[model samples]
Target: MKIPKIIHQIWSGIDGPLPQEFRSLGETWKRDYPDWEYRLWDNKKMVEFVKNEYPEYWFVYQKYPFNVQRWDAIRYLILEKIGGMYVDFDYESLQPMCEILENKTCCFSLEKEVGSNLFKVFNNAMMMSTPNHPFMQKIVKFVFSRTTLIPQYTNKNLTIFNTTGPYALIRLYETLTTEEKEDVYLIPAQFVSPFTGLEAEEVRLGVVNQKLDDCLDNAYAVHYYVSNWVKTNN
Candidate 1:
């Protein structure tokens, strides 16, 4: 089945107004993929989504150390239930995702590691799936199983990556059976993400980045790395 032409992005606004800078970035997605359905989510809608559609995860969702963690988890749940592309608000589109996602049942982008703290090869920032795909199903189960802190838990400092983000996805992905793995595509950087975190920041700060300008020449999408996750949570 082809990935549906629905796009999902979330901004908590819990932090106040959605930043002015990201508005133009979001416009790129709309411009590149015409006629696709877009769903923008906020803090309250996200909370209600879990309570209504995933009542079982209600307590776990509320107890998450940071709202960003919930942001990471809900994307998987949404994709699995309805099947669509869940792109981060910081992500910009150079072209429609239709071609890259045309043949895959589920897909993830290859992340360029820029720091020691970034511990995963894949980024959930740009993901696509068909409804009820096994890989997404597994992610839902994975998120729940590791959603809370236990005595054996590490990263007590609190990180979005390890707790419920891409690192958790990478961990579960490694255990997938050969058959299940076949249906999930790990797309290389050139197509979805080509810049390192440092480069993304450089571009955002208005520094001239010729290499990334070139990457945009080839990639269908670029994640601008507008970080919403706090390094530590209370």
Candidate 2:
């Protein structure tokens, strides 16, 4: 079955409107898929909607120290309630989303490794799913379970990654049965995020030179790793 042609993005109003850097990228997706619906959710609207519809999560959601965690939570909620595609604001589209969603009930991006590791990690930065897909429901439950038993951590990085980033998603995904995994598709890093977090700085500096074109050549969308900017500015 074809996934619904809806695109969702979340941003805190505190940041003002979508940054100019990402505007053309977003517009490109719209131009390529005129029939698709684009939905942008800001912080205030996200909180109000979550409070009314998912009251169980409101208490924990409000307690998150970083806006990124809240943003992560709401993306799962939105995708669970209304099946569609969720792309990070920092991503630039290189192709129509329909081609990616075709013949898939759910999809996730496999993140590029920043260091030596035996296992692959999937990113939550971009996801597509049909409404009420089991994978999304599982994520909602996982988030609630973590929030209810908040743990003490040494640093912000660990807390953030464990709470709402790719690490948490990877942990939950591992628990799924073989049958449940069949409906999900994992797109390679080359197709969504060719750069690892460590290499993201080069993209920001525009120092990649010729390698830039090669990295993006096979990607449907390139994730600019803008979250790295958040850490630096803070």
Best by TM-score: 2
Score every model by TM-score. 0.89, 0.90
Model 1, global lDDT: 0.79
Query: Number of clashes in every candidate structure?
Result: 0, 0
What's model 1's lDDT at 71?
A: 83
lDDT of each: 0.79, 0.79
Q: Under the 3 Å rule for N, CA and C atoms, how many clashes does model 2 have?
A: 0
Worst 10 residues of 2 by lDDT: 225-234
Q: Show the colliding residue pairs in model 1.
A: none
User: What is candidate 2's TM-score against the reference?
Assistant: 0.90
Local accuracy of candidate 1 as per-residue lDDT tens digits, 1-234? 388888888887776787777877888888987888888888888888888999998877877766777888899988998888888878888877676677888999987655664544887888999989988998888777643544335554335677677777888888988888888899877788878888888888888756767766678888877775644353
All-Cα superposition RMSD per candidate: 2.8, 2.3
Q: Tens-digit lDDT track for model 2 on 1-234?
A: 478889988777665677787777678778767888998888788988899989998877887776677888899999898888898877877777566667998899888766786776887889998989999999888876645247667667777678777888888788889888778888878888888775666887877577776787787777877773256322
Give Cα distance to truth, residue 94, candidate 2, Å.
0.8
- lDDT at 134 for candidate 2? 90
